[model samples]
Target: MSQLRVLRVVERAHGILSSRDADAPDVAQVNEAHRSLRPEEVSKAVSACDRRDFLSMSACSLATALLAACNSRGPDEAEKVLRFAERQNEVVERWLLRHTAMNHARGRIAGSAFPMYFISKTLPVWDTATRGPWMLDVSGLVDRPMRFTLEDLVRLPARRQRVDHFCVEGWNAVAEWWGVRVSELARVVGVRAEAKYVDFRSFDSNFHESWDLESATHPQTIVAYAKDGKFLPPPYGAPARLHSPIKLGYKNTKYLTNVVFMAKRNGGYWSDQGYEWYGGT
Candidate 1:
């Protein structure tokens, strides 16, 4: 079935489901139309709903039915359905980030035991002896590509935020962070009009993550240099690291080395391996 036709059927289903006087006859007709669509057709219809901003509560009711119909198919089709659902989730998350303010309450600090993680076997640290002094290189799609030393970042206006950090593994911690806001750096470097995404690279086995420009420049997003009133410890991304309550823990790259403003997203360490690209908390 054509995507447009599928959408019409889904919309009809939504209307029937929403009606106070929905009758057996009306529901049966909607069911008949819905059952006639193949899994791919239903997927396309859901994508269409997402594009049209029809994934509201009404559309979700219809989608639940449509997905239920497709669930009988084999595992490959089930995987496709999963991907479609994840995409819809990303759409909702991006919309929320754009429309709402993240909770920045000064919660109790997690302190030394805040779960430490890195791709490397040992904690990734700046090898001052081998790699020389640590420097943050900001380049790509900006008028003034510049590198900043730790001292330079400390000299810039700093913001302190106490926020919760959520991990994909279902653990979370609250910490106090002090750093220069990413938006301030953008202003100083003159980010180009064409740069739609920001890529943060790390020395942690070349781990990196890309973010939409909006999230990258959020007032809460920062290259953190200190935590809980002391200079950042090596295990907690000393020298500098990206930190934001707006994104999941993995999205905030640690052991930072480079920041690239890009015209397109280049997937990050975990995101490239099937973690959601948006990675919103």
Candidate 2:
């Protein structure tokens, strides 16, 4: 999507997202960009929506669109962006339904009504040695592969940003994020010309996702270490989670365990649920 379109959706909705501001009241420019955009570009944005419309979206829905866009340019993983919406098509018949937008620690424009998943782990934290794998791997079509534990990540040079959180549902919040520069990791991995996609898998469940290498190494991209002031909560994919600019919430798998480099596009967990595999929102 055009930067103007991306900005207008967030600006007009007052949605939360993480990125540098270009200008104010982007609606006119955004509309012009939308008109000038080639058919393919327009389709790209339209395809991202499952059941999108001016009213089909609540304040929360708009928040999700903007914040998600602000975090990073739509995933460079592929030319396609897809998402699965579990909406039940219950016409809201009312305009003043009180839709509000906010930001998250990752600075995404999002709708808070959807909420996030929080899984509990009651492991033996009491023991100092049984801290699981302790290391996350970033390896693919590169000469250098990385295997860093939580400690290793914290020790590395870090970057921080304040941005809004966007959700597929509706609602948003802004927060600060601190993590390793994604570009640094890309250099460490030695991204090759053959490399095209970077897949992410979480440690929590089998939640997995893929992104184009371009978006992976974008300046806004990061392998975060902390949110706000405290360590990442388990529910928020503690230890490590990708702050991807090119994907939707579902694509941003939490508790990243592995980063696989690939040459073709791959579908995500929710893709089979009637959502597009390239869900960029």
Candidate 3:
């Protein structure tokens, strides 16, 4: 399954909202729609939506009552009500998207902290023997496409730097990384003139991200194999990962397996989920 399968559930919820009478959907109609959803689907709708959606419905009286009821609940219960509302109304979701706050990547020097955070439980891990057969496939919009092994990459001119990492989840960490600069990879691959973006693919759950060609080839962008002067651990993305000081942590995809230069803009995992697409410093 795709790493983004949850997006489908969100999309389905939107479909239900769209099929309703936009001018005003009655509370009974809305209730029927909610009740028709599967238990897991209802959870997805609630978890994925925000409060504004419910308020925008034509049945304002019912929605206002729901809001009042929500206020009397605990924080967790209130949040669930708001999320359910957001998922139930498409207009509300769009409004929330417009109001979201996003920060540009800072590219700052590392501070002392280096806490690690992993997103998915199904992270790909490899030992020296297991990684021996692993190779990074570099293709698309390049003259000299190549597959590079870990040893092959280590032989290239390598760089090390301490960079501040910012997550979309509102956390930051600083760590030292060692890897071959992405610009060198571009040069070695003979990137074509029309290539305007670089798409990175991960080994875990088909997680992927794309960056503008300029950022992709930036000096601070590298395919890192080591962290804090040691081989990267599995929790930190072993074998190799894409690292960039000028992008959000999500944009710096981990367990990187491929790099493809292309002309079109491809939305990333979180970016598709309403995060900033540029995500630049």
Candidate 4:
């Protein structure tokens, strides 16, 4: 089946399972969906199921039955079928992602109140007195590992773009961001060709995320210092934070501390907890 069609089937199957009422039609739908998949795709789907435990007992039983009706895998080996579907979704999302700059029209900007999100119990402020002045460290797979004071970042060439911010929880806002483009920083530091991923780390409970190099260096991706024409307040990740229209809110780590380039992907905090790792908008 085509990628899009395959994804639709997976989504249908999930909805059926979640409803907790997999009736006769739902079972037939799942069987028909699997019948459309190529032999290699079927094998891979079954293999992925065999590799990981399911997130819940009920989900496991439901998915196991769904797969058993088609592939005849044992219940235990069918638990991660959903995970396989997720990986396929990621592959399709990555293939479809583009680096073209998003339209940032001034009229699209939202009201002044952009939602603030951080995992720390209290707002995370950079205690310069205790931690010494906050510095952003850029290292790993680069010709010159460097540290930048907030002032140093301000001194770099700046870019301003108004873009929509999407949250995984189903809300979105539009805001203007001003900061040095991460691509500029990569150019200055001389990122090694082998570095295919970028890891963004934050001081807010050590929350972090990794991104493919293509998305990291997109023209609009920035390490933002200002929002809506004002220097960021503590609630909005003062000092500096990663921002991009291409990624979801959680992928843009706030209260920034470190940026590392790596050859392989290291999953993020939310991603490690079962959120989609790619997190594309």
lDDT of 3 at 214: 74
How does model 1 score by TM-score?
0.72
Candidate 1 weakest lDDT stretch, 10 residues: 16-25
TM-score of 3: 0.59
Measured by lDDT, the strongest candidate is 1
- The C-alpha stretches of model 4 lying farther than 4 A from their native spots are 1-79, 101-108
Q: Report the CA-based lDDT of candidate 1 relative to the real structure.
A: 0.86
Q: Sort every candidate by TM-score, greatest first.
A: 1, 4, 3, 2
Residues 1-281 of candidate 3: C-alpha lDDT, one tens digit per residue: 23244444344445654565474555565556555656655555557544455545647887677777664444455666665664565343333432123223355534335555446676566545965678999999999999999899999999887776777667777688899999999999999999999999887776888888877877788999998888888777778999876677889888888999999979888777766666764
Model 4 lDDT tens row, 43-144 = 444455422343466688987877766655445555598679889998998898777746464446675667888999999999988999999999999999
Tens-digit per-residue lDDT, 1-281, candidate 2: 56567545544444233245554445665566546656654544546653444357677788787677664545444234322122222122112122132223554433333244633243212122665565678887877887988888888778786764555555445656788766787787787789888888765645677776665665656787677766776556677788743345666767777887778857666765555455544
Candidate 1 lDDT over residue span 1-281, tens digit each? 66677777877777844555545336788889978887767766766444335547678988787777664554455677778999999888877775248666555788987987789988887888999999999999988999999999999999998988988899789999999999999999999999999999999997999999999998889999999899988888887899998899999999989999999999999998889899996
Model 1: residues with Cα > 4 Å off, grouped in runs: 1-74
What candidate 3 gets wrong by more than 4 Å, as runs, is 1-119, 127-132
User: Per the 3 Å backbone cut-off, how many clashing residue pairs does candidate 1 have?
Assistant: 0
Residue 223 displacement (Å), model 2 = 1.1
Per-model TM-score, in order, reads 0.72, 0.55, 0.59, 0.71
| Every model: Cα RMSD to truth | 17.1, 26.3, 21.8, 19.5
